[model samples]
Target: MQLQKKSKKISAIAQNKNLSIQFSLDGFSFCITDLTTNDVNLFSEYIFEKTIASPELLLEKIMYIFANDKDLQQDFKSVSAIHQNNLATIVPNDFFDRNNLVPYLKYSVKTLATDFITYDNLSSINANTVYIPYVNINNYLFQNFGEFEYMHHASVLIDKLITKIKNSSIKTGFFVNVAPNLMDIIIIENDKLSMYNSFSYSCKEDFIYYILFTAEQLQMNPEEFQLTFLGKIESDSDLYKITYNYIRNINFIESTTCFFNEDDDFSNHSNYILLS
Candidate 1:
């Protein structure tokens, strides 16, 4: 398949070596990252969509490649790649035979990274020939792995980053704006415990509904737990104005920097945190 050249020139750090790519397709995102420096390279979020795969499997697949590659072990201490719609077919052939990864595949998969797994490796589908059409394509199709993969990477990298910041001279909580696709409130404090809640909704009304639901559950006013909102907002987005109005007294900063810029050392990226 022909790939479209990206025109948007986002800033990136110049390096001595070509960067390694990592792709992740778990959860609600198709994400790509440059693992060399914990930099998020590319991502696409699938709003209000769900997936059958777990996020851990996506990381394992990419990490497996990184672990197996000799050059990646040496000069490149990190891995990077983008998760796109192709993940339905991107998993490697051996992934089906690994057996270790089999338990994870609760359902039959039509596509592995390079080749198609046989009918035995897949779950029984109502239609026998459904996935036969996409047997040989290298590019991903019909899957939204990019957003979730990016989130998985971000969650892991950000945990380490929080430690780095705590160790640094900075004294502030790391504010993060997760894409709606990976809309979860997992609190990875100290990178040890995974604690967080999931919030779901499509528009501002839905967001408000979820917030109200949270408020009702906590038995506190909506304002009690400081809330912050982030994502791609057009100039006329009502949420932008509504959020500003609700949290007028509090601080709300745009979180574009966390998306990854080649020139940054991730030091300036800490200020984008949100807290109550």
Candidate 2:
């Protein structure tokens, strides 16, 4: 892998000591704040120089965060891990069987001995089964943090997007969330989740291809339905340019949830997944 930019970090003073941690294969991010007042004390985003494919490497990064930020080592009011691996699937809530999660993911992802089966129930649609391939890292989290919640990245975004659609008048819309090397495409119609899936892309063309093809397969007119973008994308980016050229009604989503501080540098669309 070619060398990329280093991580980004930001912090603020806090009135109380509450912490939330979220991380993925591409980055680790956390926010420390007072839940009562919603005052964020510290927020940081660390973009890994290379893709983390092993549990050992993931542990090293987690250890590095704890070593550098002594505050994270202390007890917090809450702690949560938003696993962001692309190996996820959404099954209808009524038909979901926890015991059969592995078979569903096996067809899409390679079986790994360390992969743990976890699921997050959507607000009104389906359950997302995520194959989190970080067994040793999860063990370390359990040993250190006693009891913490685990959520898939897609689940968080889906939850937020569902809320947005319900509150808005738009009857149909597609949300395309872009990450470093991943793209999560979600389709919503009649105020319900129609489809949700993630795809890997190596270039701008590949990224736009998936979006256009998915819309075509769904028989959704790109020019008719509104397409909202989230996650790591910028209006000036090639990914955005290519997508805009192919789709007419494309716009970036604004952050409405009070997850980040007003002073935080996290972008509305770029950091949506991490900050959600």
TM-score against truth, every candidate: 0.38, 0.88
Which candidate number maximizes TM-score? 2
In angstroms, the error of model 1 at 263 is: 17
Local accuracy of candidate 2 as per-residue lDDT tens digits, 124-241:
6656555554666667788888887777877888887888888988888799988888899999887788888889888888999999999999998877778898888878899999
Candidate with the greatest lDDT versus the true structure? 2
In the order shown, what is each candidate's alpha-carbon RMSD?
13.0, 3.1
lDDT of every predicted structure (CA atoms): 0.34, 0.75
Candidate 1 lDDT over residue span 149-195, tens digit each: 12123333334444544465533322324333333332223432232
Query: Against the correct fold, how does model 2 do in TM-score?
Result: 0.88
